[model samples]
Target: MKKDDQTVTEATALHSFDAMLTTYERWAQPCSQTFSRAALDGAALPVGATILDVCAGMGALAVPAAELGHRGWAIDVSPGMIERAAERLKPHAGWSTEVMDALDLHFGDNEFDAAFSVLGVVYFGPETGTALEQMVRVVRPGGVISVVNWAEPLGATFFIPVSRAVDRFDDPEVGKFVAPLTEFLEGPQLERALSGAGCVDVRSESVSGHFAVPSAEIFMEELDSVFQVLPQYRAAIAKDRDRFRDILVEEVLLMASKELPPARANIAYGRVPTPQETVGSSGLATS
Candidate 1:
């Protein structure tokens, strides 16, 4: 992908994450437990099916799917995430890993029985309509495509408050962050987008994020991991790195203390519409 087309400072973000992936994966087990269950429930893949895990960070579901009667092709954009996925899925017989973009996935038409993204697809790009169409296109007509993402920001980490804090960026083609005023990429927008993208019986629900963690220590670690995107998080704030960290930490602590509400999710799933019908949906930027 072109430098401008990808997420900002992805290399630095990877390095920042190198030391934390293992810790975060371990810490993520609890959250993953919740997401995986909800994801499967939402997508309801048939056994012995082929699946694609997009933005398959660290192969969380890809690795498990190997042992769960399904095979998966795990594709990621981040080199670091791909590296970690390789290591994690090494012993899995039904898993393969590759580096790719969600916006433009490389697969023949109707390539798999199902596709699932876990809290991924946070950034569906400027053409969410096209991205959703692409993701749906990869699945068989009667098969399923499910996307998992935070519907709102109620806790320590989310693109919402930070987007609010910043001067309302309009970079819809890349980052998950966007102006609250934008009508094309939100709750109702998501439903319209999915339906428009030719996904039938499309729906979403609240899943996971309500349970507590082993401790606040693990939570803090994950917080720090994502915040390493200081430069990308708040570009101006990063001008004075130390000061930025302090400000971000204080704001996050406040959020953390605010009773980490259950994570809300929009788990949309439906049969991939036939290509003929897919061409007729009416909508724009329904991510």
Candidate 2:
């Protein structure tokens, strides 16, 4: 990403979630609480393990991990978010939160016993390729790596049209910001990425959960305000703001007419191969 693009991304994030910190937890309550435990369980770290929570927002998993007897180190790009997380997690001695980009983690090699990013990695898109590599590099050989992404089959249906609309109207330089939205649509693709990143026994499973919003209009409102959609669609919003919102409203209202569950997602799990194991003649390691 270019410096300008990075700047825009950072600003957009700070404006979106950081600015809305008062409402983020309430808005995200359903999904975060529903899926966070599964993510921690998937890591299956023993007692006292040191864990990294990438893109950690509001210390959702970070605080809980500390309570579970692990050292939880959390990082995010938003200073406001870091501040809020630090405040919320201050009472817990086993946790700490920092402001940093996930793609350029500054920690030394094998610095963590395990690492996980829940729903957060998806925002980084293919950039997550580098983020995952960073996780692999920092975690000790054989440490577990896990991520939870919005699965296409169930989760994307509600949001795809909105993302597509943004990409269609946004500047060409941005080049399909929604493309990363489908990065983990297929479990096999995610598994392959993990394998390519030198993770062994890679596994991705569709995890089902539900979001209960009062109405379709409220859903659209929160989707635009609470989530990071505003940043991706910033250009379009500037170009014709109300029209963009109208388009999303129309689409979401149509989906809501179905009267089904509001949301669902998938979780992918893998482990960095231990140093004693050889991956292939390619000079990597495998479990």
Give me the overall lDDT of model 1. 0.61
lDDT of 1 by residue, 1-287 (tens): 22345433324334654656765566554465467667775676767789898867787777777767788799877777788889878886777888877778899889999888765554544555666777888988878877765555422234333543333332332244433222232445566667777777666666656644333333334555654453345453434445444544555456667775665555666567654443344532122
Q: Clashing residue pairs in candidate 2, if any?
A: none
Among all windows of ten consecutive residues in candidate 1, which has the lowest summed lDDT? 176-185
Q: Would you list the C-alpha lDDT of every candidate in the order shown?
A: 0.61, 0.70
Candidate 1 off by > 4 Å = 1-33, 153-187, 211-225, 230-258, 274-279, 282-287
Q: Evaluate model 1: give its TM-score.
A: 0.70
Per-model root-mean-square deviation over C-alphas: 6.5, 4.6
